[model samples]
Target: MALWSGRFTASANEFTQRFGASLPVDKRMYKQDIAGSKAHATMLSEQGIISHDDAEKICTGLDDIEREITKGTFPFDINDEDIHMSIEKQLIARIGEAGARLHTGRSRNDQVICDTRLYLKSRISNVMRANYQFSRVLEKLAHEKQHVIIPGYTHMQHAQPVYLAHHLLAYVWMLSRDFKRLHHSYEAADCNPLGAAALAGTTYPLDRQRTTDLLGFSAVCENSLDAVSDRDFVLDTLYACSVSAMHLSRLAEELIMWSTQEFGFIELSDTFSTGSSIMPQKKNPDFAELVRGKTGRTVGNLVSLLVTMKALPLAYNKDLQEDKQGVFDSLDTIYDCLTCMAGMISSMTIHEDAMERQAYTGHLAATDVADYLVKKGMAFRDAHRIVGHLVLLCEQRGCALTDLSLADFKAQSSLFEENVMHELDIPSIVRARNSRGGTGDKALAYQFNVVKDVLHQQEELLNALTRSVS
Candidate 1:
């Protein structure tokens, strides 16, 4: 018989039983279910709904169940339908009517929501810590490569020169935004939803605030129907995960390009690479490829949940059960992908010489050259055209613009002088950008100190949180 089979004349058929069961996937929620039950039991005792003695018995029983499940000694029955029912059934069998009283003013609708919120709070904390660790690794890499130079680009054409650290810090800032999104999602999941019974408030004189405090929730949910039917917390979390995965995919794509011989910007370690079966010398960045590919699944999980909830009516429905699997998958996938990315980044070798070589090939110093001519009293527009003509002459002669002699430069502009040679060198151009946030050594050093401060603050916050949780 099912938990709600009191008035039914017959049991569900095997097909119905199999189709209705969530035990396979929702068993992961057993610990959450147990935790919520303990909070509810404490509230009940406080509100005089159940005896303190009974609350103690229920709490002890839940603790025992937790131990049994952790040790793989608990028996799960297929007839229990879901994790909540399975645990409730066990509690009743072990402690009699006190276990039956556990659900006195509660329903599975709110119970499941409570468990989910509790689960997300913990998972988001874990992700935030992982993100902080990854950020620290990136900061360390940037600090190590502060002197390296690379060409910045626009439309795949050389635009200017920038420090390699400047390029890497760009992604660190992008992921910092991702960290903020996860924090918002965590706030959305912090409200307690345990007092809403089905689609209406129960008349059992239940103390919702007591349970809210016991569960460490920031507040109790405002509306009963909204509380039971709401899946927005899950959606917010899934959206955050999807966006973070997209960020990871973008970084992975760059890693793939960087590790290639054509780019020669970086090289993955053997542990983070793979070899082709037929090509003995081929070393591929398979980890980056996997991270790039896994992004699609995380995005799909977001769309799946959005589509599932689009047509559902008010209050709880069977359609809501479809919500858990996708969120679970998204969380698990992003966590694994972030860990893999951090490992790859921490171990990969940066090819500074190759970066410097490519930085020089694209005439990255052309802008500086044009500026030099303007400073020599040439009309700014005239200087730009003169440099443009010089670039054309270099292309026609199969030589770099810097390779032109003083006579070659004088042919384009009378203002051209020997000092232009120093201005057109890659390192000189990179180092000359002394403005704040520029690619110059002073700017990079300032930026590095700022990033290091942020890292230290992040570590301190994480340590404080760890102590509180412990």
Candidate 2:
């Protein structure tokens, strides 16, 4: 018979027992379940709701169960329904009547929510660290390849020249925002919900603050119904994971495109690439493609949780059991994708010469030519029209802007001067834009310094979380 079976006259059908079980999905939270039990027992004893000897025995019994689970020596039955019931039943069997006293003022509703929060708090820290690691790789790549010039595109057409460092740093900023989202998720999960027993306040003299302190929570959930029913923490985590995975997908899509024979901008290392079984000359960027594809799963996980929580009148529901698997799967997927992306960025080879060649090929200097005319005091829109005609002339003549004669320049606009020649040089064009946050050398150096400071702060935060969770 089950622990709650004392009120029932008959056993549950086998299929119903198996179908209602969450042990498989939630068994990973065993440590959190044990820790919550110990805190609750200690609080119960301090409040004079239970005997000190009974609380001590329950704590010792929980410690034994934790050790057994950690060592993989504990017996787990699917009929136990979930990790909380499994550990509690085993604790009662080990410590007799005292073990049964552990849940005196609590219900599984609050117990499971408390365990989920604790579990997510730790997992959020881990995902944050992984995100930080990926950002560090981007930072390192930007610093090392600071001088590599590439054609910056808008609408997939060459629009300007930018340092490769500047391009990579854009993704770093995206990841920095992802780190903030994960931190917000951590804050959402830091509240203790252990005293919100069964959607209402318990009658026993329970000290919620003591359990909060014991569990290292920053505060206790104020409303019992809200505490057990709210899953916004889970939603926050899924949102963070979803956005971060989308960033990774964007980066992966670029890597896949850059490694192609048509682009030749980069070559993924042999270790990160795979060969076609049928084609002898094939080396594929399969890992990047995989990361890009897995992003769909993360997005679906977020939507799945949202739909699950959308319409239910909360307080507590069996539907909440659907929460952990999606969150767990999304977190694991994002973590693995982050590590893989970091590996790809760290190992790939950049073809600087190819990038430079492409940087100069597509009339990339057209914008600079117009800027040159503007500097000569031509009306800006007129200069744009003149440069447009000049580009068309160059196209007809099968020559570049730099290849045009001084006469050809004067024919387009009298404002065109010998200085226009300098504007056509790709490197000169790249270095001319020295405004704040531009792709110029000085701008890149400033951004790199900012990245370093942000990384230092993230390291401090990660260390603090490590201490708190420990």
Candidate 3:
């Protein structure tokens, strides 16, 4: 019989039982559901709502159920419908009346909400930790490649020269912002909904804050209906995940371009790349491409949840059950993607020579030569025009600016001294960007220190959580 079978005389159709069963998905929340029940049982006993001896027996039986599930020895039934009833039914079979007492002052509505919050909080913490690790790998790469120069692009056209480190740090900043978003999502899930009961507050005298503390929540939900009905926390997490996945997709897009034969700026490790089925000499960035493609599903999951919740009223409904699978899917998607990306970033080989070589083409140092003229007392606008004309002549003669003679320089502007050639060199052009936050050595060093400190703090938090989880 179903848990709510008291109100109905007829058995549920087989199709209905199979279709409505969430065991395939919500079964993942088993550990959390058991944990919340243990806390609630302790609270029930401590408040004299249930006998202390019964509480001990319920706790012991729940531990046994956890072991049975972990070892794949427990009988999981589809007709149990979801994780909550499955665990409760198992408890009753194991410990009789004490197991029945475990649900004192609670409804499956609040119970499911509580379990989902705990599950989501733990998952978000993991994603935050992975994001931190990915960011650290980026910081290390940026520091190692600080002196390597690359062409800066505007509209995919060479516009200036920038240290490759600066480009790497740009993504580090984006990931750091992602970490903040995950933190906010964690806060959204950090409240206790266990005492919300069905649509109204529980009639029993219960200590909601005690359960909240036992489970490590930051606060208890203030309103019963809001607590049970609110899947906003999960939506917030899904939204944050969608944004993070989008950021990763953007990075993956660059990795795809950079590893191409045309760019040749990076080489993916063999373990990260895949061979073509028929092509003779193909090393494909399939993992990066997958990361890019998964962004669509994660984003779609976010939109699905938002629209699902738009019309549902204040308490729990069947529509709310539609929330968990998408949330769980998005989390798993990004978690695996971030972990893989971190592995790829840490293992891949960088082609510094290729990066430096590309920086030298397309008149990358034109602005440096123009700056020399301006420093020699020409108006900035005049300097720009002089350099423009020099480039035009070089194009006309089918020669590079460096191939022109001193007379060629004198023809353009007598201000172009012999030293102009040295000033227009590629390395000099990169070194000239000495302002704060520029691509200069001093700027990269400063950026590295800032990123290192943030990563250190993040690592500390990860270690602490790992210890707690263990």
Candidate 4:
């Protein structure tokens, strides 16, 4: 019999029972559902809404159910509708009337959301942990390759010279923001919403604060209507997942490009790579490409929920059941993507010689050449024009700026001097950028220190969140 069979003459058809169920998706939240029930039952007893004996029976039944689930002995039924129903129906069968009293002051509307919030708190903690670990991998990579100079690009054209650490550090800062966003999502999920029965307060003297404390929630959701209606916690996490996935996608794209024979900047580890069946010499960065490709699914999950929530007149609609599957998928997807990304980066080989060779081919020192002429008392525009002409002359002669002699430089502009040769040296150009946040030694050293400090903070946060999960 259905829980609400008193209101209906008979149960819905088997097709309706199976089609309307959320058990397949929400069964994974069994632990959270059991925890919520135990806490709610305790609160009900403390508030005198249920007898102490009944509360004990309910708590004992839920504990036994949790163990059954952990040991794969629990029978999950498609007609149960969701995890809340499956647990409740089983509890009623085991403890008789005591289990029926468990729902004295709450409804499945509020019950399911409470379970979801509890579940998200734990999952987001793990997501943030993986995020922190991956950030550490990138920081280690940057420190190892600190001195490797490569050409920085704008519009995919080399515009200046920079340290490889500078490039890797860019992704670190992006992930740092991702960590903060995930923390915000955790905070959003940390609120308690258990006592708001259905769309309004129950007649029973429900002690919401007691349940909040029992469940370890930081705050009790104050508005009864909003408590059952809100899905913002899920949306916040989905948004964070989308943003983090996008960051990983950007890194994946660069990895794919760098692994190509044309760039030769990096070689993915054999463990993280695969080869074609017919092509004997190919080692493809398939994992990186998959990370890039999976970003669309994460983004689509966010959009899927947004559309589900956009026009709903809420206080708990049937449409809200659409929330869990996508959020669960995104959570799983992001964690796997982060793990794969860390594995690829930690094991991949860096080809410094290739990076340096490509750096020399792009006339990467042209800006410094322009700055060189400017320093010699020529107007900046006139210096830029002179450097442009010098680049043209080098092109015509089929030579680099260093191959042009003082006589050849003087032919283009009288400002040419022997010191210009020193300016054209690749290392000098990189070292000359000593301004704050520039690619020079002093600036990068300072940046590395800041990165270390940021990483320390991230580690502390991950530890705190992990402790909270336990």
Candidate 5:
């Protein structure tokens, strides 16, 4: 018989039982479920709702169940409905009446939500650490590739020159925002929802604060109805994972493009690459492609939950059971994606010759040359028009902007001179961009200093947040 079978004459059909059961999905939260029960039992005993001896038996019984579950020795049943009922039934059998009394002041409505918050509070810490570790990999790459100049692009055409470090640091900044979102997600999950007890306050003298303290929650959820029904924390986590995954997907798209023979900007190490079985010479950036492909599902997970929760009215609804799987899938996906991205970024070989070669071509210096004409007192619009014509002429001549002699320049406008050729030098062009946050050496040095301090703070925070999780 099910836990609530007293008023019912018969059990749910087998298929219905399987369909409704969350034990399979939520069995993963056993530690959290057990921890919630322990806190609840302790609070019950302290408030004289249960005898201290009964609380002792319940706590000891849960400790035993936790060990068995951890060791894979515990029997899990789907028809038991959910982790709460599965554990509680066996708990009663093992500890007799004391275990049955553990749920006196609670309902599965509040219990599952409490378990979820506790579970997410720990898991969010891990995701943050993984995200931080990935940032570390990017920071390391930024240092190593700081001087490597590459063509900066807009609209898939070269617009200027930028150091490779400058480009990689863009992703790091995006990830820093991701860290904030992830931290907000963690904060959302840190509130205690245990004693909301099925959408109404309990008649028993319940010390909700004691359970909050016992469970390490920062504060208690104030409204009983809102506490039992809220899925905002889950939504926040999903949103965070979705945004981070999107950032990784963008990077992954770049990796795929850069590793191609046409671009030849980078080479994936054989360890992170895959070979087609039939194409003996093929070494593909398949893992990066996978990262890009997997982003679809991460985003879908968030949308799925949003749609699921849209119409449900709610102190507690079965629709809420639809929450955990998406959150679980996205968390796992983001972690795996981050791991793959870190490995790929760290191991890939940067082809300096190839990047340098491409950087020099593609009329990359056209804008710099225009700036040179602008410095010579030409109207900026006129300079842009003349530079456009020069680019067209370079295309016709099949030569580069730097290849044109001063004669070719004097023909466009008398303001052009030998000094204008200096602008054609890619390194000079890159070095000249000394504005704040620009790709110039001084700008990058400043950016690096700030990012270095930020990364250090991220590491320190990660260490603090995850200390209790592992």
Candidate 6:
């Protein structure tokens, strides 16, 4: 007989029982469910709602059930409907009447949310750790490749010369924002919702604050109905995962382009690359492509939850059961993708010669040429036009701007001088822009220091959160 079948005259149809069961989707939260039950039992004993002896029996039975499940000896019945019912049914079977007292002041509505908050808190910590690890790899790669010059692009065309370190740090900053978003999600999931039984406060002398502390929650959810019904924490987690996956996809796309024969900027390690069966010459970035492709699924998971919660009326609904699978899937996806990305980045061989060869091919110093004229007393707009004509002149003459004579340059602007040749030098072009955030040597050094400081702070925050939970 089902736990809630006390008033039913007949059994539920087998198909309905199987279809309604969340055992498959939520069984992964067994640890969370058991942890919540233990806390609830302890709180109940403390509040005098259940005798201390019964509470001990309940806690002991729950501990045994957790061990059995962990050891693969627990019997999981689909008819039990969810992890809560599965464990509770086992608990009652083992401890008899004492186990029945475990549910005296709680409802599955609040109970489920409690378990979810506990589970998501740990998950958020894991993702934050992964983000920090990946960001560290990026910082290391940047410092190692700091002196390697590459062409910076706008609209898919070469625009300026920049150090490879500068390029990699852009993603580091994007990931730092992603870290903040995930942290916000963690905060959203840090509240306790255990006493909001069936969307109303129980009449029993239940102490929500006791459970809050027992479970390491930051606060008790203030309103009963909102506590039972709220899924914003799950949505926040999904949104963070979506944005992080998007950032990974962007990085993956760049890896794909860089590994291509035409770009030749980097060579993916053989362990991370795959070769075609028939085409022996093809070494493809299959993992990078897979991470890029999986971004759609993570984004879709966020949208799925948003649509599920769009118009549902207050306190709890069957529709809300659709929440866990997508969130679980998205969290797993992004963490795995982060691990793969960090590995690929850490192992890839940067081809500095190839990058330098391509860096100067598209008249990449044209802007520096214009700036050179700007410093000489020519109006900035006039310098821009003169450089444009000079680029045209080089194209017609089948040579580069650097190959042009001083006389060749003076024809366009009297500002042209011998120093113009030095201005066209690629490293000089990169170094001249010494503004605080520019891609100059000093600027990159400052940015590296900032990245280190931000990383140190993030590590401290993550350690503090870990200690709180511990």
lDDT per residue as tens, model 3, 356-439:
888877787788888989999999999999899989998899877888898888898989888988976877777767787788
Residue ranges of candidate 4 with Cα displaced over 4 Å: none
> Where's the lowest-lDDT run of ten residues in candidate 1?
461-470
lDDT per model vs. reference:
0.88, 0.92, 0.90, 0.91, 0.92, 0.93
Candidate 2 lDDT tens digits, 190-292: 9999988998888998899999999999988999999999999999999999999999999999999999999999999998999999999999999999999
Best first by lDDT, ranked? 6, 2, 5, 4, 3, 1
Judge candidate 2 at residue 261 and give its lDDT: 96
Regarding lDDT, does 3 or 6 come out ahead? 6
TM-score of each: 0.95, 0.98, 0.95, 0.98, 0.98, 0.99
User: RMSD of each candidate?
Assistant: 1.8, 1.1, 1.9, 1.2, 1.0, 0.9
Model 1 clash pairs are none
Candidate 3's C-alpha runs over 4 A off are 374-382, 406-415, 467-470
- How many clashes show up in model 3? 0
Angstrom error of the Cα, residue 179, model 3: value is 1.1
Candidate with the greatest lDDT versus the true structure: 6
Deviation (Å) of 360 in candidate 5: 0.5
Show model 1 residue runs off by greater than 4 Å: 374-382, 467-470
Q: What value of lDDT does candidate 4 attain over all alpha carbons?
A: 0.91
> Against the true structure, candidate 1 has what lDDT?
0.88
* Each prediction's number of clashing residue pairs: 0, 0, 0, 0, 0, 0
Candidate 1 total steric clashes: 0
- Predicted candidate 1 versus true structure: per-residue lDDT over 196-233, tens digit per residue: 99889899998889888777888899999999999998
